[model samples]
Target: MYSVVILANGLFPSTEKPLELLSQADKVVCCDGAAAKLLMWGREPDLIVGDMDSLSDSLKKRYSNIIKKCDGQEDNDLSKAFRSCLDYHPSSIHILGATGIREDHTLANVSLLAEYTELLKDIDCTVDIMTDSGVFYSGFESMQSYECKEGAEVSIFAFDNTLKMTCEGLKYQTDHVIFDSLWKASLNMAKSSKFVLKLNHPAKVIVFICND
Candidate 1:
């Protein structure tokens, strides 16, 4: 079973209502004081992980199974949790509460996505971060959108070189077009209520270089 990981938010936003679907996860992990937020939501955090900075004493006492303590200022609790993931080897990792804070810290957390490729090696892995700007990630050809509104927008750039794209139903469709290797990613609009993108040629390619 995969584990849903929640990172300590320097600042929690009011718009995020992720708990509405929290029950879908097989297990829950709190990266530091983020455990308190889950506790406040009437949800029991399976594990309270990370250094004990923001995590209160009570939280530590209540859930000790996942309450892993790693003291370090060089990295945030999110980083610690990623390292700790190796021990459990969760099949899937869903990250919530990983947005808003010091711009640098937020950048650091986003940059952590790259370091995780080592963990993602030879495994199907993805990271989800909820933010006002919206969700982002790479990998996974068939993305099942849980909540993309009629007018809500999302943009995906090829991580490395441009991909040979065959968009199914976008406002501007591409039919086996070779997108550039080192160029801007084309902004495609959704045409049908739901859409899927399948890369043409090289059906078995993984790990792309992205500079967007």
Candidate 2:
């Protein structure tokens, strides 16, 4: 089992529970300023990878053993951590300090997982981000519509071709629905089932999220 924890820049309140979640990590990798955050929690990262822009002389002196300096111009520490993940191929990677940021940064970081789609698929690894709202998207796959109540919202999006959606326990049911692009899909919470979702492109990565 591969386990890696990455620390990135994000909202303070958003990182409140990171310490708790990160405690279970076998190996922790602080990304740039993320070390500072881990330090605030009184924890030392197993390996801190970044451009060295975020480390301080004081923090470096304290956790010198694990720090692995890298060139920032090439990629962010987050990317470097990903490379490490590929090498180690951990069973799971819990990323902290990655949510509730500038829309561009948040979007970019979230989508960053897409870069490792092949690696992730090969290892069947799941990566989840600990956000203030909730834990989500450790990985992706084709899912079928199931029974759900009305007023329940399911956000569906695709990285490739359309995903076929069908449901049983829903106020509204689609026999063989197709979803593409950045469209929001949800349930009213009025129904549910093992609603089935068939993707025309099963190899594609699909996203399902709950707004409520």
Which candidate leads in TM-score? 2
Query: Clash number for model 1?
Result: 4
List, residue by residue over 1-212, the lDDT tens digit for candidate 1: 66555545555534434443355666676788877887776778776667777777776777766678888678778878776665666766756666676777666665566556445767665555544445544443333232244433444444333456555545665554444432243454554455555664422222211111
RMSD (Å) of each candidate, 1 decimal: 6.3, 4.2
- Against the unseen true structure, what C-alpha lDDT does each candidate score? 0.56, 0.60
Lowest lDDT 10-mer window, candidate 1? 203-212
Error of 2 at 77 (Å): 2.3
Report the C-alpha lDDT of model 2 over 66-116, residue by residue, as the tens digit.
777788576667788777655565788877777665677777776676565
**What value does the lDDT take at residue 184 in candidate 2?**
37
Clashes of each: 4, 32
In TM-score terms, candidate 1 sits at: 0.63
Off by over 4 Å in 2: 12-19, 72-74, 86-89, 138-153, 161-183, 186-196, 206-212
